[model samples]
Target: MKQFNQFAARPSAMSRALRKAFVYMTLAGTPALLSTAAYAQAVANDESTSATGVGAGDAALPTVTVNAAGESGQHLQTQSANGALGSRSVLDTPFSITSVTADDLADKQILKLGDVFSNDASVSDNSGGYSAWASYITIRGLPADWQNSFRIDGKPFLGYGITLPYDHFERIDLLKGSSGFMYGFGTPGGLVNYISKKPTDTPVRSVSVGYTSGNIWSEHVDLGGRFGNDQMFGYRLNATHDQGETFNEGYLRRNSVSLALDARLTRDLTWDFQSIWQNSNSDDQTPSIYTANYTGATLPSVISGGNRTLVGPGQHLNTNFQLYQTGLTYRINPDWKANLSYSHSSARRNRNEQTIYLKNAAGDYDNYRSDYLEAHTYDQWQAMVEGNARTGFLEHQLVFGASWQKQVNDYTVNSIYQLSGTGNIYAQNTNAYYSNTALRTYHAGEITQQALFASDTLKFSERWSVLAGLRYNQFEQNAFGIGGNRTSTYSKNATTPTVALMFKPEPNTTVYTSYVESLEQGGTPSLGQDNYGQQLKPLTSKQYEVGAKTSQQGWSATAALFRIERAAEYTLGNALVQDGQSIYQGLELGGAYRPAPQWQLGASLMLLDATYKKGSTFTGNRVAGAPKNMATAQIAYLVPQVAGLKLMADAKYTGNTMLRAANDIELSSYTLFNLGASYTTRLGKYDTTFRAAVNNLLDKRYWQYQYENYIKPGDPRTFSVSAKLDF
Candidate 1:
């Protein structure tokens, strides 16, 4: 049952008369501006009465109180960091987390990180979108490892081939399975933090502008408040810029800056600071289709939708980034607390590429050309001491943490050349192979890690609880040859663990179970293997889970069932062995619902099997980008009488995936749809919003990633718009 065909092409006639005059002037002037502003606020009154009356007492009006802090507008979020047993709730976490907020990343206009994790169906998008270099993702079926699974407020940043900037984030959690006792050596597939954006005791000003179809264009700014006085300082700022051409024939540019600062220093102590900078550029750099040696060919046809250019406009990509952070929080009073943090990050890149390989089934191709120079650095330090106590029925929430991380990756690869193409996958003519080639570095590398951790959470009654964790790791690696000496070095040490159990029968339900472990960082042997660079040994993984969570009234939900296992290394004949075992089992579901008060709903689902149970020869197969059902859904409304209009729709589905691991090629199954609208009011006193969208919406031409004989495509129909202001 694999059938798809729909691209009847329509939208032009001046784009259907400008989308029917912008939806009939926004549904006919939004109920006449909500009935003339509800009849001028029903005969305005502005009450005033006691100027000196009974008792002539005017001294009783001297109490003014205003207290409001941050993050509200909850689109489902309830604390985070469950693996380290820190931050809690989500019905007292046991596992499986997903937060995403900042108003759900500006109502899903998210620009990357796979657009807010594609609404989480256990995430999967191994760089098939927004890649001007790298982004790769995959969870619940491995992959992930952008420098040890990324994080920001919880430290560790500069995730490998970078591309981070989610407009100064303020939420984005996602922690699904095995976080090596809360991050040690990673990749059992899960973890992503990013929470910054603080410093707000009040005031903030905003601005935004955007456009997208292929002409891109964007601008953004945000600033925040409080300074001196009894306020004791605070600040926040975010800036951005984006530029042009990219719905295929490639071209992009970006810039960013962020800053945050805060200080209180006396009552309970506090201090925080942050900084960021980014830069990017790209031009003609798309290519990533390998076809590991064509074989049973015949699968090339599907390239409708413009912007073809198979790489040659001289291809280029560039990136630069930086970050610095600091933190300190001390309470040490009602239940104790002490924390410390530090972070440093860096990234750099320069590349030129043109891959493509498929030399059969008539789509004749071949063009290799490669070049790259990269650098990454990350450093982290953390200290924690937390406590809570109660002994009547046994209650304790304790944490003891210690962390130190260091990462350095300096890579260089230059000139691979195989150009002199034979292209033709349906009319290809990249300006007759635009030229310019001169590069020279040949190979180099480096890697490192260090860790130590601990945690606890217990509570004996009021619906039981328990959590435990541990970590200890040390790893190092290096490889540099091509004359620069040092052909390899590897070091290792390990320990990881986690445990959880919880039950609450009703204050908004919860039931859970967990066990975890993970560790990774091993690899060498390349250049036709046979102990080419050797150095391997460091991989361990395991997970087991069961979960449930719920929230009532405004709805929230979560579910899980998991199993993971690993240790699969290959090459028995040339001897790079680990002698098999890989498994993944799953079922996950996610939720949110509002039902009324202007409806809202969200959903997620994933199935997954990911086998290769124990193999010498692909035993049970299946596992290559692992996919076995995935789903997502979303809906939003609000317009109950038009005040601040809203509307939205979303969908995504994926299934049937497998491309190698001897599963005999697969990849087919797709679905996508999107639609949106937004509006808010006020223009004179400031506060305005406007947005529009229409993505993919029935213009299907699938394929969203399948490596090992490549495939990437996905993303066609597009259109976008935006506006925002608040003073």
Candidate 2:
């Protein structure tokens, strides 16, 4: 274990506190003053450009306009953000990426982040349902790190025990494989970025009402417009409220509000501000089953006790979140630009979970309860410069920038845990033995990350190009005891690199190969291990990928082959250590085709082979929770006879999954079907739309594999309907 006797090498408590305050003040108050000065400079000069600014990029390229056609057509996105490298056409980018727009969410009536990409073969809902800790997903056969895998508006946020309303976001982007050179630190699995809706150039107003299975009801309002001379000021606002019983008999109430404002002081200078708030409460959530004690090769059947809500009274999860941000963009000239931004976000959570421990394959279990209270705050600042230059025989698009981020965490010392009672899966229970109570909280720890990155795309000809990027990162973690004294400190730094080569056979075709490396926070030893509570060194991951993409004649297709090798951590002879490696190799194929003017078809398939390599009992065994094959297909038909009516159906298939490192137990394969329809028409001078969907139409009972000791029940059949009006 590492020692913690270096207090003299660190800053004093008073200095640390002052530094934190100073950073807060700078982030909160500096943007406005800086923008004022830029505005004055802008007014003094009449030379300006009308081009929009690219966000969070070292190279300030022209912004790509996202329109309704991109949202409602073809089921394919043309452009996606490549981290600090800016946005590129999907066909031209060397990495695999995907985006889901607001229109898709509304059509499917999706409420949670996991459900947004349920049809993608490369993604899986690991938790199967909402969690008091966090909603989790698995990408490329690895679970994403909930603490560090999420971002908002190109900035970092703590993704613990909070769910933001989807209505506030215009789009969600996913970057697959190692992103160390683009993003400072993250898991190799992937990254999820939520792009909030911004102010519009035209006037807009809309209202919507929706209902889901079990009588859940929701109302939403959206408003946006510009005002002042030459429409120099713009604003967009969204508000929503929902309350009712869930399909599994759980009750929930949620409220959220988001606002975006921008001031175009001059054609070449722009400033923007954003604020978001959300509060949600859930009760009687469906309980997850613990299979550690069953010891049976054959687990309990899903139909035996699946879809059962074991939660009783006094059990609930409540969360609150808030975020504020400000940024300024200045177009130095047509060939170059500069950007600066700062943001702060916080989350608070209080939750109690009802847990069940399985005793046998016949559905008997012991009931228990667990409680948690935690708060997290984060602050980040970023600056970038981007430009285009040509020298002799090559043209270069260059970007360079730096960023700093810090997070402070507070948690209860020891959460309350109590045994409620014992019961059988076939029986029923609805009594509470304990009530929610307050617990003492203490400062847990803090983490800081800093990065400097640069990238260049060298275009040698219209048909060939190369991209090279590098990032230098430093990470620090400090642990504190309950008495407010620092117990341990860890600091590490590394430089990651990425390189790619591309070839374009045609205007709409691209073939590429890329290699990248990443570093991620390591795992801590669990109970019963010889080194329990000891933190390990950072783990490194590497990936190699080759892919091809094309879009032509109302159709698009993509194919990729990749391999990832990540360091593994497991118990060896009752001692936890980082050794060996987990290797994952996979092939992915996806496409969309508009066979005719009224018909659209889409499909995706993934084949993965994952294994653990080491001289141990787990050697050569299939990785736990990884599936070998996954497939999805969907079709939509626009009725030629009806003016604006569309019908759609989709199906997904998942192969058997390993449930333990020993590979002695496995989950059965399952397939699901969904159906939906939408109609658009004019209602009393208002453009109106009505949508309906039936998820899990076949009502199949299945178990979602999470890890070695936990399994969750798939949601039951559910129905949803909604209506929206635009004015």
Candidate 3:
């Protein structure tokens, strides 16, 4: 049998049975799915009530209350923090924020968080295109922690260290800058919030099948509806499966399921629940290449596009994640509300990896093998009370909240060994032999955090507003060494604040200035470093920003100038040190415009100057992994003659970036282009949509810079096509 066929048939009997059960369930639910479409059509065509109701003919119709839960038209605006801020406009917020809507995800064929930020000038990922396990992103020259910077519906999500499928999200919101006052202890870079698809009041049912380069195939189903006598109960479910080889010489398999429920228990109280499960595995995974070990040897030449250093075929990685969340909202009065929520998440991973360490200038290297089993669990709870009031000529929106989070991690390095073989990067050889010697001990740790926060937004006049917020946090961490012996305990307390002022000369324009601070946990030394396993003190950062936003007709524009300063840490000789400071100052410009009814344009530019202000030996050098400049622009046009037909083109550029604190090694800049086309039509009564896209149009070869001389290569040219059907 062919390799693909063999892979498809490799599942055990139990796995096959489970798959069959899922298929049977979907088939049995066909009636409900069909009814959903019928109900939606009926609601769209029902206008009799508008003409024959109690307020008929000459009388006015009752006011309708509409909730903006997700992005609608174009991806220009959002209300992601509405629950906490009382549904304020994005333009009115004193921070840089952007929303990627469902339409954008569909049009771009986004599958992961990295894909969502491919066109964002302010965002970059460290893993590049080599790793499919988890993504690490940076914003505004600061790194965001993979486990702490992700949120679901404005609440922290602990399942971020695993694959986050895009199929289950309605929209994603990005808040740039320090979020300490909002989310307590976290990275200063930014925060990413995923809004789940709510139960649809109008009913929804859709299925899509797709194929991408490297024989990857995917299938997804989404269903949502409102039921019950008064339609007070609603549900939304999503399922997806993907399998096959990736762009590289590796195999991937993934499955995910998500369900959400909404219930209106009383006239003034509502409850929501959500659950998600996901499993993913990759074989022959690509490993990150590090060049720091090549002390006196010349660096290897850049590998050609679409190629990578070969490793043992047995290397693999697997991850499983599960999450559950529940929340309740109670309206005390017309202007007062209370909210409470809780979430729990668990994740596990098994990895067997091999790294090639260069030994000479001729590409000779040693193969190092490592195996690990790890698990993580997180629990979080939050409660808040908010109200809107007016006194004399001043209007105020106030919020008071408290949150607590706990995280536990356990891991064991099963084995670490050196293989006896010398390999060349320019040649293919994977027959290296290795023997495992000693077994590593298991380690465990726990982190707990409690925080109290409050914010007030005062509208002093029709064209002026001021917002201020503060957060006080207490954090504690405990570590256990081999044999469950208590190793170390650390605790700290911090206070952070945010303040902003806004002025509007016109109804459609806003100018703002803001100051914010963030607090991050300390770093621990790696296994091979001197003082290994030692923890340093936490770090704090401050940011100052001034910006303006404006919207007129179908066009929107924003500009910002910002500066951030923070304490830094790095290895000096053999010991890790924190006696360094860094600063990043930059200007950002972005805009979206629909000049004509059928044409749309989006563009962004970022210019940064990142340097070490004070360091032992690398003072005044460029900060590692920070590019000097980045820009992206896209245009989409719809053919008026052929309805539902749209064509898009986009280009991205990244300037050179330093790979080390010394600024001796740098990754050259590169530019890439992408093209896409999508069409929507009706086949009889079934609505259908077709999409096709080509990434890296010119097959440009480039490298993504990382700290410590580690480099990741960009993906080569790839093609994808998908079709969706709506019942």
Which of the numbered candidates is closest to the native, going by highest lDDT? 2
Q: How well is each residue in 1-727 modelled by candidate 3, as lDDT tens digits? A: 1565697778645445544543444343332223344543343345335546643443322222211111123243455574334456678877788788776787777645666776678876554442532466668777666557777777665533376778799988888887778777667778888888889898899877777776677778899999987999999999988888777767778899999999999989999999889998876666555555665523556564365455565666778888899999999999999989999988886667666666556777766665656677889999999999888988999999988999887766554444635577767757443333343436578889998888899999889999888888899988887688878898988888889999988887889999988887676564345775555667888989999988777788888899988887766666667867889899989887877777788888989998898767788998877889999998887655444567788888888887667676677888889888776654335566667788888988776654455665666788877777788
Instruction: For each candidate in the order shown, give its overall lDDT on alpha carbons.
Output: 0.68, 0.75, 0.73
**What pairs collide in candidate 2?**
59-386
Taking the tens digit of each residue's C-alpha lDDT, what string does model 2 give over 204-298? 79877777877567777899999999999999999987766677666777889999999999989999999899999877677667665666788
Clash pairs, model 3 backbone: none
How high is each candidate's TM-score? Answer: 0.32, 0.87, 0.88
After aligning candidate 1 to the native by TM-score, how far in Å is the CA of 539 from where it should be?
Answer: 18
The residue-by-residue lDDT of candidate 1 on 1-727, one tens digit each, is 0110121133235434434544544443344234455632332221113423533243122221111011212233366654356776656778787777776576567656766777788887656434542566678766676666777776776564467767678888878777777767767778788887877888889877666777666667789998887999899999877766767756676788889998998889888898888888766755666666666634576664435556555666778888888888899898887888888888886666667776666677776655656677787777877778877877888877777766765655443344656576566646333333554444465566766677777778888878877778777877777677887687877878788888889767878888978887654342333674455767898899998887777677778899989876544444455657778999998877775667777788999888877677888887777788789887777655445666777887877677656665677778778777666664434556667777767878865663334565665777776666677
**Residue 112 shift from truth in candidate 3, angstroms:** 3.6
Clash pairs, model 1 backbone: 291-709
Pick the winner on lDDT between candidates 1 and 3. 3
Per-residue error at 240 for model 3, in Å? 0.5
Candidate 1 overall Cα lDDT vs. reference? 0.68
lDDT-wise, the better of 1 and 2 is 2
Candidate no. 3 TM-score? 0.88
